[model samples]
Target: MKQATRLMALAALMIGASTAAGCGTSAPVDATGLRRVVGTDLIGARGATAADQRKIDRTAVGLCAGGVWSKDECERHGEGAR
Candidate 1:
């Protein structure tokens, strides 16, 4: 039937589009996860200050907005502050 063929084509197009969209998309990351995304050095270097730490914390909060990861994601990655 023409209607059945058209529906099948539309379904195939939708599936192909969704798959193609993710072709260029990278996986999302948490705070600990971000170290893997951007690297541990950059995250630590820029996260040294109270203000900078706050920025990292905020970004982590946004990343794990749904509580997907624990609070440590927003905490300092190193031993202690200087």
Candidate 2:
């Protein structure tokens, strides 16, 4: 009975160690990868609201006006991919 308990404990520890080794934190997402217009803007770090379309539009215009990211990069990634 003691030996069986010890084996079970050892198995549990191995399983936990293996799982930890395989686990990883996911990378942050890029907004331009979004497929829908709904994702065009955001609010308070979440996402855009339909009621705030005009506000979002203005924000988008301001952002797009500067053209921070080069058009060449956008074309390389097939456009709208950030």
Candidate 3:
């Protein structure tokens, strides 16, 4: 019936909205990300590849956005990875 179709469409719209919201969410700063930030900040990303460096940078941004690290601190440490 038209009522059933309307309900199904509403459900689909909600599901799609949730999926899009999730995709927009940034990756969390987890334990591994923290370790990488600390290691690279203290020692340096001397042996890290370009991709690894990029990951570290992204982790720093996540940490900053999550209030784990201050923007100045992240910048001072070169995005938490020297």
Candidate 4:
């Protein structure tokens, strides 16, 4: 009876650990937020001139395109092409 109880406790502990491990694996992607951060990092705090801003936008689009962002979204931002 004690051995059975110990086995049950071990099974419960394994289940709990598996559930906790799965919890950290499923975060949603924030594409718009990512783009904004990338743009700001590329541009600068004071901001850029029209030409510079265009360049920054293109670079941001390219960066996002290489990752999870869809082709349509990347094109909308003007970074669609390789």
Candidate 5:
């Protein structure tokens, strides 16, 4: 009975560790998705010239891909971009 309890505890510990590790990893960024977001934002704004739009796109990409924003924020914007 003691050995069975020990085995169960060990299994539980392994499962917990794996779950924690998975939570720490994030999904890869979708570049096209992010670009679409920047495009949408630029379109929604009034009086943004082509030059201004280009600049905004560059800045958005930098922010999302340069590790300035969290993965969740990037993903949120990516979804919006689409």
Candidate 6:
């Protein structure tokens, strides 16, 4: 009975931690999904080259145009080169 109670407590703690992790300000774009869409490893980070940045911007604008993402979200995700 004691072991069962401990297991239950551990399960509850794990659930709470996972829930909390999803509650914060998360990235607008899923990196893996974006990579798939862009077909490149370049993430348009602060250090990205101009060409890479342009590619990222084009993808973001396409996402926005297609209603896959909002303008604000695109901007927040650092893909808004406009």
User: Among these predicted structures, which one has the highest lDDT?
Assistant: 6
Q: Is candidate 3 or candidate 4 better by lDDT?
A: 3
* C-alpha RMSD of each candidate structure in angstroms: 20.2, 21.0, 19.9, 21.6, 20.8, 17.1
Which residue segments of model 6 deviate by more than 4 Å? Answer: 1-47, 77-82
The residue-by-residue lDDT of candidate 6 on 17-76, one tens digit each, is 445545767734434543344343233333235564555455555555655556786666
Native-referenced Cα lDDT, model 3: 0.46
| Candidate 5 collision pairs | 36-81, 37-81
Model 2, range 14-76, lDDT digits (tens) per residue? 356445545668643533322132233333322233344443333344334445324663343
- Give the residue spans of candidate 5 off by over 4 A: 1-47
Model 1: residues >4 Å from true position, as ranges? 28-82
Better of 1 and 4 by lDDT: 4
lDDT of 4 by residue, 1-82 (tens): 4323323433454356445545666764544544453343343312234554455455445455546345774565453223
Please give the range of 10 consecutive residues that has the lowest summed lDDT in model 6: 38-47
TM-score of each: 0.31, 0.30, 0.37, 0.32, 0.31, 0.36
What lDDT does candidate 1 reach at residue 65?
A: 52
Off by over 4 Å in 3: 1-47, 79-82
Candidate that scores best on TM-score: 3
**How would you encode candidate 5's per-residue C-alpha lDDT over 1-82 as one tens digit per residue?**
4323323433454356345545646854444643443333433322235554454445446556656556885575446335
lDDT agreement with native, every candidate: 0.41, 0.38, 0.46, 0.45, 0.46, 0.47
* lDDT of each residue in 1-82, candidate 1, tens digit only: 4323323433454356445545656843323543333232223325335665554444444434544334674343222322
Worst 10 residues of 2 by lDDT: 33-42
lDDT of 2: 0.38
